[model samples]
Target: MVRKKREKDQEIGGFLKSIEKIGNKLPHPAMLFVLLSVIVIVISHFVAKNGASVTYFDAKAKEEVTKSAVSLLNKDGLFYIFNSATTNFTGFAPLGTVLVAMIGVGVAEWTGLFNASLKKLLINANPRYLTPIVVFAGIISNIASDAGYVVVVPIGAIIFAMAGRHPLAGIAAAFAGVSGGFSANLVIGTTDPLLTGITNQALLASGIDMQLAPTCNWYFLAVSTIFLTIVGTLVTDKIVEPNLGKYTGHYKSDDSELSELENKGLKKALIGLIVYVIIMSFLMFPKNAAFRSFQEDIGKNTLKEFLDNGLIPAILLLFLIPGLIYGKTTGKIKSSHDLVEAMTEAMKSMGGYMILSFFASQFIAYFGKTNLGVLVSYNGAKFLDAIGLKGLPLIILFILLSAFLNLFMGSASAKWAIMAPIFVPMMSNLGLSPALTQVAYRIGDSATNIITPLMSYFPMIVVFLKKYDEESGLGTLISMMLPYSIFFLIFWTILMAFWMFFKLPLGPGVPIFM
Candidate 1:
């Protein structure tokens, strides 16, 4: 009977593996997005020609589609496609944030600053506590753009392997922190302003007189940082790490010794980074500084104007200055040619992403033009509001809906761009804060990033996995991350519920509800 059971398990595993093989051969995520968007656009045109209408509930009221395909194809609707496409393709779009942020990141990566620092930090840190520390650091690293994805994740896998644990477990833990904890960082990053800008636009669309501050969720995120770190650590060790059992593969850990020059270079980079930050802070925040972006006024404060206008440049400089200093100190970049080469190397790595982004931008723009995203979000929000759901049930439903939508639409901002206009207003009508609604949306959006193959990083992770086990592919990666996803979803949901029950502030100057 025992032999028969073992044979049966083997047969099941084989069958599953065959299915995954077929799935992995499908078109890349970018191609898939483009194809789907084209289909939606074509179908929408036909539907408009036929004057097809879809019914949806909103603001606890019933709504029916009144516009036709031709109507949607007009200048106002068509303009959105071109406009959104431009935004998506440019550095302002959701995809652009990662790519643009990577410019600085790639430089730092090329300069060996991150690699050298991680080796030194991990070597000195306690192994038993290293897992959670790495995960927490990954979450914090989001302020530095794609640094978390490129630096922390791969290093995490290496760290785990060195500690005599499964390397995949390290990847999962780091992924949970980097991707899953994306919206839960303690410090506000570039994404905060981006998301807030969209949220403010949505609020204005609803005729609300409000300013959605970028750091609105900072306090809540700080608390969540601790919560997620604990959860990531526990899940990695108790659930993910144990399941992989012993490492049977011949995956050698990174043992390359850091050169003396590299060590000195890192010290110089750190010192340079500090000096750059101090100079920037003085320029941006000093009371009597001439660098203030706006005149002090009752309505427009100097700090506010600076935050609105100068943050992007600050973000760019944060990476560029440190990176250049590191490169120069390490002798990796002594001349203008070396500097240009560093930037070129960065762009070269982005070839795959650029291809993906082109398609993703087209799809998102086309979908927005067709009003499919708006239609879906409006109807979904209406239905939930009509049901009069509140508290945990409302948040749980939102999480599932966001996760479902995430599979088809990988861009978080695009999805939020559509959903926020409808959901924020609908929830506000039901006496909930738009900030709280945004928080719930963020929670749902982030939890599934690790498991979703549509995510741009998903393919890169699969490539990483392939290095460890040749048979490892998309299915292997997704299956390994599935536990983390499910666990994070439950844990985060519960934490949100607890926060709501206690009526805790979601962030700085942001209430949990109205």
Candidate 2:
């Protein structure tokens, strides 16, 4: 029996090795984006020349609309390509957010606060629960938008390295939680309202006379938060870590005990962090909170607006203050010049990611300009509609379709806007609730996030991996993450099926069947 298990493991290793080899053969990340951009240009021209178009329900327009591919080979297209190059690079979503977040994290790292705190945490944290804790943190981070990718993922690596484990495994585990479990959260997050808006629009356009709530999937996702944590932890321990074999990279596990000064710094840092949290609480929780939206549409004192807009700066301050406190306590940051140098070093590390983001931004921008994503999504939905599938098979296929489309499109709300009008009503006709359809979409949308380069944060993750292993390439990252993706999709689908079979409520007062 042991021999058989060994054989199976070898086979899996061989398969992953092949994937790594093939993926690494592709161009460097920057060049790959350039190549993909060119491909999108060529394809858009060809499709436009043939006059390919699709008619689908537009939730925003509240009417059926025809979308045709815009050819980037045309004069107008060339003008746009040239005119938007600067903005494309500048307006890239992840670039600014990551750089800003790193400024604070950089201070923490430079002051040795991270190292000290990690060492103390290593001694205090139970080895048995560390993986689950990291995974759980990743899951919970969804409430703060992209905070997980920028903060939780790299910290995950540090935590593992401190524990004398593979840092890559740590990254994978956290990424799996942050991206793979994106739709599963204990609290209502920005995604809820974003998706619920589209769902209700779909219902309205279809004349259903029923509106879905933002918390439509809350109950199920809350449960899934725990479910995915267990699954992610198991996959990390049983499959991902073992496949990685052992940590043999530039990062060595630091088992050194913290000195008295370091201990004092950590205590000071903790106090600083608590103080920061309390201040933020006062600003956020009050009826007339400082960060609240006073906009007529969103209403006054809305915490959601703060979460969406103010959280990043708050995070920056969160780390910056604690780091400064820790640095002062340890005499590592003696002056203003030291603080500037720490932030400068952090930005220095991000130089390579910025270059990659420029090309990636163009590729993403070009793809959107060409309207290929919309065209493909509309056609895919139409194909699914024509297939006349029902019951479990239909639900499973919708999940698969959403997962497939996720490879090409990164925005969850955007994709749902295009798909909801079609599937929500189609499923309604088949007696499934729109909430159930949205649940299926979320499952598919999340499972593939780690593997897709188009995802805004993908380049940042590459940079993180390179810090530990300079030789790590797209293939290396993909091969590492594919297991998590596959297992997540498989088990998440099964969980959905289980919910369906049991006739469980998807959320508060939201049933699986209409």
lDDT of each: 0.70, 0.90
| lDDT of predicted model 1 | 0.70
Name the 10 consecutive residues with the lowest summed lDDT in model 1: 56-65
Model 1 agreement with the true structure over 228-341: per-residue lDDT tens digits = 899888877765666566787788655588889988888888898899888877876677665664544233425555554545556656777788887898888889888778
Each candidate's number of clashing pairs is: 2, 0
* Candidate 1 Cα outliers beyond 4 Å, as residue runs: 1-22, 46-104, 141-172, 187-219, 239-256, 287-298, 301-334, 406-438, 449-477, 502-514
The TM-score that candidate 1 achieves is 0.72
Q: Estimate each model's TM-score.
A: 0.72, 0.98
Kindly list the per-residue Cα lDDT of model 2 for residues 395-495, writing each as its tens digit. 99999999999998888988998999999999999999999999999999999988998888888888888999887888888998898899889999999
Question: Which candidate wins on TM-score?
Answer: 2
